[model samples]
Structures are given as structure tokens and as C-alpha cells.
Target: MDLGLKGKNAIVTGATRGIGRAIADLLADEGVNVSVCARKADEVAATVSALEAKGVKAFGQVVDIADAAALQGFVRASAEALGGLDILVSNASALVQGARPEDWKAMFEIDILGAVNALDAARPHLEAAAGKTGDAAVVLISSISAAEAAAPSAYGAMKAAQIHFAKGVAREGAPKGLRCNVVSPGTVFFEGGVWGNVKAAMPAFFEQMLKRNPTGRMATPEEIAAATVFLCSPRSAFTTGINMVVDGGISQRANF
Candidate 1:
């Protein structure tokens, strides 16, 4: 199905690999120009080249989302390079799930503040794009862990915070023809990712998690990306301030 996202410009953070990379690639597949950022220069370049292969303009930069200056710079530069911004996907995370104070701080800085800073930097361009296209979107890559916390975890807390933040953003941005939403994914596995490593080093734990999913498997990065892109699409123009959970039944809570 046509997503009506052709020619749109997007900035996706942490797009070097995993779910972020999936989202960026899928956006390019739908004919959207994408600007992506990662800390590693080689990964950034390689991802950009791959996206460009899909016939859309792709830009990449080495950025540390924990650094506010660098994060904002990448956003502004991307908007300029793409001509305007129609979508912003905040997918970067420190992945600090530990209970330590420093872990909490790092998660807050990278996960929560990263999304805030990106939206702030992209607001002008999104507003401008709205003027011409009548719509704009921002999707936060949160996690199901937000509602399903089993222990003291900074990651869960910050992911939950993102959902709250996006709701407020949705209300404020709607008047400007902008939509804001969250995509909370469950355990998603990919090569070289956390789960993949767990599957290799901790086979018993990995099997436990796999069995916990009624589907008998964790979600693929592409599954999460598909949900996110749909929410960001013009076809879902009326959708905002909603957390779309793409967990493949691994998360048992019902949406209220």
C-alpha cells in the first residue's frame, strides 16, 4: 500500500543498526529522503549508502545523542540537506538498563532528552513542511518495558517518560498540522544485537524469553519499523498521542 510518504524528509537517530536502521531503510523504501546519525563514522556512511541505493536521498553523520550540541546540530543540518523535515524518529538509546545512578542518568540524557532535543531542533522545519503539505509527524521509539517492568530499570522509566512526553507533544503539535506518537516494541532480535548476544552467551535465558512469547519468538526489527512508519504515514493523519505496541503478544496488557 502507498504510504503517501513519497518525497518526505526524515531524520532518524541511531540508524546505524537494529530497529533504527530498519525504520530508516523502510522509509527510504517508501520514497522518503532520510538523514540518520550514529556514533560510528563507518556505520553511518554504510547505512547512508544503503539507503541511497533505494533511490532516495540519504544523509548520515556521526553523532552522540548524549551530547545535546551534536544531536541538535545533526537535526538542523539534516533539515537543511533534505530541504525540509516531515518526519522525525527518535530511536537512539543508551540502553542502560542497570539500576545504578549513572545508568539512570545516561538513559535520561540519551533516551528522554534526545527525543526532546531532536523535536526542538526539527520543529521549525516540521512547521514549514506542514504549511506546504498539511501534515508532519514524529515517532518515538519507546519500549514495552515501560509498562512491563520487572525490576528497577532506568531504561523502563525513561521509555515510559517518552510516551508521556509524546502525548503532550501531540496535543501541542496538532494545531500546527503535526502528529506525535510512540511505538513501544517488545524484545526485538537482530544480528549483533542484545538478544542475539544473549542467545549465544546465555542459551537458557534466551530460551526462556523465546518461550514467553506466545508467538514462540521475539519480534524482528522490521516488524517494529513497519508499525512506526505506518503511524508516521499520512494515511494515519488522524493518529496522534497514541502508543502503538508492536510486541507480537509478548506483552499481555490490554490497551485501555
Candidate 2:
């Protein structure tokens, strides 16, 4: 299907690696211009170069999405570079694994506030772009943790709040012709990422998750990214304020 994403401008946070990088690449492949950002300047630069080679208009910068001012500046610059913003993928997150309230709070700052800040910063640009093409969307890369408690435990709680935050953005943005939605994924492995550590020592955790999954496998980042790109594209024009779960039936929670 042609997603009808040609020439659209998008901003993808946390786009240097993992799921966010995959999302950016998918958008770029669909002929969308994408601007990416992450805390690592070199990683962002490498990602943008690769996308540009794919014949997509792509650029990037370094920014801590947890910082409102930094996020605002990145959004402004990305909008200007891409000509405007029609799709915003807020995917940056910091996961703190500790059995403490402080860990949860720290995760909230990056996972929840970061997504909200991106939505706020890109709202006006998205509205304008929507006005131009009658299609605009924001896709947040939340996790199944929100719906189910995570191994880290605290991560899931903050992610659940992220979904609600996206819903709220959708409600407020609807009148302006912008749609906001959440994509909650499970077990997306990033190369050399923390999730690998969780999977390594937690044999019981895998068994528990696999027992619940009809697919009997962990979700790949690419799988989740494919769903996300569809949401941002014209294909899912009417979808808004929804959490599209990408778990392998893990969230289904069935009793054997």
C-alpha cells in the first residue's frame, strides 16, 4: 500500500537507534522527509546520513528530549529543515531499573514529559501541515509495560501514563486537525541495549511472557515501526487517541 506519505515532513525523537531509528527509516522509505534527534550527536548524524542516502530528505541534531527548551529548539529546527511537520514520533525514553519511587520519577521525566514536550512543540507545525494536506499525526513509542508491570517494574507505570498523555494530546489537537496516538510495543531488542540484559538472566520472565503470547515470540522493533509508520501515514487517517498494542499477545492476559 502506498501510505500516501510522499513529501510529508516528520520529526522523530530517539531516532538514532532501536525502535525510533526503525520508525524514522520506515517513514523515510515511504518518501517522507524526516528529522531525527537523540542525546548522542554522532549517532544522530550517522542515522541522518543513512536516510539521506536512501533518497529521503533527512537531517538530525543532538538534544535531550527531557529538556523542554532543547526539545523546542530541535522541533523548530526540524520543522524548518523539513519545510513543516506533519508527523511527530516522540520515542525518546530513559529507563531506570530499581525498586524505588525515585527510579519511576526519573523515568517519568524522560518517557512521559519528553513525549508531551514534543507534542507541545510540534503542535502548531503539525496543525499547519494538516491544514495543507488534511493529514497529520503524532505517534508515541510507549511500551506494553504501561499495561503490564515491567521487569524494572517502575518503567511500566510511567509508560502507561505516556499513553494517557498521548490521548489527551489527541483530544486537544483534534480541532486543529492533528491526531496523536500511542504504539505500545513489547520485547523489542536493541543491539547492546538494556532490554538484552533483562532477557538474559530472566528465563522465568520469558517463560511467563511466552505462555501468554499466541505468536510465541518477542516483537521486533521493525514490526512495531511498521505499525507506527502506518499510523502516521494517510492509511490510518481516522485513527486517533488510541493505543495500538504490538505485544505478542502478552497484553491479552489469558489464563491457561
Candidate 3:
């Protein structure tokens, strides 16, 4: 299946490890020029080298997603480096699960505002790309926690807010051929990731989470990345304003 993504330019936030890294790699594999940003200079450099090794133009920079100016700057720089931006994926998060006020603030700053800032910075480039290619996309990485509620969680609340934001972008950008969508992953596991740390530190809780998935396990970062990249592809030109859940049946709610 040719994704018709070769030569397209993309920017992915937090594209150094886990799902973000997987998405960046997959995009490179599809022959898309990629620009990535993360806080760690070493990881960002390594990721760029790895992507360039795949024979695609790649750029990276150290960026703090919580800082609006820094994040917007990265996006603009990336668009300039990559020639233009056809896809934008906001994958950075604060990963704050606590109920404290500070935790909520962190999530709002990094997750909510980060997505907003990235879209604002990339909108012009994306719209210009749409003028040339007839399609442009923005994929927001969200989570199944947005639809589920067990306790007070800033993470879930902010994720839900992202979904709402994406919907509005989708509607507003539809006429401009700028698509916006959300990909909600559930219990993604990778080495040194949240689930991996949970499995090592709290085996019982990890096992409980595993059993909750009908697949009898969790999703891999690659699995989530596949869904994300596909949504950004020209083949999915009409797939906008939709929250695609790649949760391995862990989420029970049916999409209407």
C-alpha cells in the first residue's frame, strides 16, 4: 500500500523515544522528510541521525514543549528546513497523572497549550501545502483515558481537551483541505516507557492492566505509529475530525 507520502515534509513533536520516535521512523520509512523536537539534545541528535540514515531529510532541535515561544520557534524552523510542512503531529505531554494543582497546570501547559501552539505555528505552512498537494494533516496524540473515568486525573482531562480541540480544527480546516484528527492509544509498552516502568516497579498492577485488554497484552509503539502515519497520509484525505482509537479493544465504548 503506497501511502503517497514520499517527499512530503512533516514535523513531529517529542520525536525522540517511544511512540513519537516510532512515528518519526515510520514517516521516514515512507520517504517523508521529517523534523523532530525534544528536550534532550542527545536524543534529538541521535533521532535525526537515525532518520537521515533512512535516506530522508531529517532535522532535530532541543525544545521544551511547555515553552510556547520555544515550541513555535521549532515548528517555524522545521518548516524552513524541510522546505514546507504537510503534516504536523503533536505528541509531547507532561505525563502528569497526579491530582495536585501543579500537575494539572503542567498538563495544561505542555499537553493542551503545546498542541495549540504547534497548530498555530504550522497552520500557514499546512495551508500552503494544501494549496499545492490538496491535502494537509495534523494528528494529535491522545489517549483512551480521555473517554474513561475512574478518578480525578489531569492527564485524562487534558487529553479529552485535545480531542475537543482537534474536532474544532477539523471542522474549520475542512474547506481548506487541512485535516485534523486524533489518535488515542491505550497502554502502549516500550522499554523505559511508562508501562515498562510499571511492569518493573509494580508487576501486579501491570498484569492487571494487561488483562484488561482483550488482546491479552498491550500495544506496541509501532502499532500506534502505524495508525498515526496512515491518518497523515494522502490516502486518508477524507479521514478528518475523527478520533481513531488504537487501543487493542481495551476501550469498550463504541464509536457512533
Which one is best on lDDT? 3
What residue runs in model 1 are displaced by over 4 Å at the alpha carbon?
Answer: none
Per-residue C-alpha lDDT of model 1 across residues 74-185, encoded as one tens digit per residue? 9999988888899999999999889899999999999999999999999999999988888999999999999987899999999999999999999998988999999999
TM-score of each: 0.99, 0.91, 0.99
- Residue-level lDDT tens digits of model 3 in 172-227: 99999999999999999998999999999999999999999999999999999999
Pairs clashing within candidate 3: none
Winner of 1 and 2 under TM-score = 1
lDDT (10s digit) by residue, model 2, range 1-256: 7889998999988888888889999888989899999988789889999999989899899897678898888898999988888999988888665659788777878888887788778888998988988879998888877766536577877888888888888888887778989998877665556556556878688567666667877777789999999999888988899998888776765422
> CA lDDT, every prediction?
0.94, 0.84, 0.96
Off by over 4 Å in 2: 150-152, 199-212, 253-256
Q: Relative to the unseen true structure, what is the C-alpha lDDT of residue 86 in candidate 1, on a scale of 0 to 100?
A: 97
- The TM-score ranking, best first, is 3, 1, 2
Q: Would you list the clashing residue pairs of candidate 2?
A: none
True-vs-predicted CA distance for residue 4, candidate 2, Å: 0.7
